[model samples]
Target: MDVGLLFDLRNPAQWHRPWADHYARTLELCEEADQRGAGGLWFTEHHLFEDGYLPQPLTFAAAVAARTRRARIGTSVVLPALHNPVDLAEQAALVDLVSGGRLELGLGAGYRLPEYQLFGADFQRRFAGTERNIREILRLWEEKAVTPLPIQDPPPVWGGFYGPRGARIAGRLGIGLLHISHAMFGHYREGLAEGGHDPRSARVSDLLPIILAEDPEAAWHRVAPHLAHQVNSYRQGSVEGTGRSTPLLTAEDLRDPNAQDTRGLLDILTPEDAAVRIRELTKDLPVRHLIFWASIAGMPDDLVTENIRLVTEKLPPLLR
Candidate 1:
């Protein structure tokens, strides 16, 4: 179980300080995590969310690569539906070279309707566009003399899948798989098998919210509102396009639930009681890596460091 860190570039009220301070602290956290023997850093991409989220993952990843010495840098999921494949390929390749080949590219279809509208992209064709863009990106990386030649070897790419079709595509393409939270867990293994991929040979990773504290009660107070807001954001976003109501969950829902709510399923552990639940939720899964989104709701740098130390120092030895 390799461990990694996830940064959402949250624009929370608590972090209303200057952007430079947040950026500097983020770099420090990455370096600290690297020194503590963490595996990687995963950054997310979003647009038009005044909530202080980043819209450009490749640019952010490039900065991370320049600052960190050993930890691999990755995009949790870049929306290929909204990007030009050629430019993405070039930028990703340049970052790969800068990092000495330590890049993990996770590509995904655009999901948020606002982002689609803002970018002037047709939301309906997102899946198809994502598939085509990924194919072109692979071609640009694997083939030589692609009009504008890249600077280094092709970086390893991963398909970010939230459904069965995307999972199948990942296996067929022979790229890695990134499962966000727990939405696809039940069908992921079968999807890989259906695509004629051996489960053991598949490189599957997941990103989840995490926090570690000496006092569970105190941690809950700090992280609960943020976790609730995150869940609400997904639910609100899902309702506009899908015409479905997002279901809420109780504590009992985590253990056993009759309804299959995607948000409920994915928010597997609420921050109010995450430490113990996270340990249990990860067991028995083919988790190649566990990436912690520690900057949720703009947590303080010290808290982020404590969470990373908890995973890298305290958790792994027990798992072994």
Candidate 2:
């Protein structure tokens, strides 16, 4: 599996920087990571957040493509139900073309009721509609319905779902699945068989939320508050979808890294330990790219810079 970077470009209010500076710093980091042999650069999307989560990942991805030459550029997850298929297909095609065919399109049936309400999408029927929209997006690309077709015969697509139903959709459609646990992948293989596809023809792209450092404890000391901010924002951000009112998480709420409260699960590891963790996570799996966050919720500049260096320069040799 190749090592990659994930960016959300979140700027929480309490830890916020100037918006332009946030974007510029992230783009510069992407460029540096790309040059330093990071295998992939992935972006994710969310909207209407207090932290200003990235709303248009493709827009930022296009910028990454222009700045990089070797690394694959992609969306780890973008909500298809909230977009028009033909338009999204056209945009994806353009980005793929600009990136010289390095695009991995990941689709998701988002659960955020607030996001759906903002987009005027049907929240209850999001699964069915999202599946349909994703298929249409693929069809448009295959049929050359959009100008400037993608450079690859067709760039790979992934279903960003963590459940059995979504696994089946991905398998039936003969696409990649983003989530993979041993149990979940059993369902994926079953779906492949049900869809009359070869069971061995499976692919994966997933996240490994880690901070690799020579000193793990010191890294955690610097990373805890940002992790707290991250966990709290997601909790607050999904209240409408989950119907759960979660009080904001504080550093006290996250004193134990193993606690359920800090579900963001940021692991601070030395490079050697991280490689071993990556192995344990993906043993006997068909993983294409295993990614780590390039920055946390506006982490300190030095910490972000150090993590980037470790991800690109230090971790690769250990994995090999």
Best by TM-score: 2
C-alpha RMSD (angstroms) for model 1: 4.3
Name the TM-score of candidate 1: 0.82
Span of 10 residues, lowest total lDDT, candidate 2: 256-265
Native-to-model Cα distance after best TM-score fit, residue 232 in candidate 2, in Å: 0.5
Question: How much is the lDDT of residue 1 in candidate 1?
Answer: 60
Residue 205 accuracy (lDDT) in model 2: 77
Per-residue CA lDDT of model 1 for 253-276, tens digit only, reads 432445555323333233335545
33-148 per-residue lDDT for model 2 (tens digits): 99899999999989888788899999999998999998988787999999999988988888899999999888898768899999999989988988899989889988888887
Q: Give the TM-score of candidate 2.
A: 0.96
Overall lDDT per candidate, in order of appearance? 0.71, 0.86
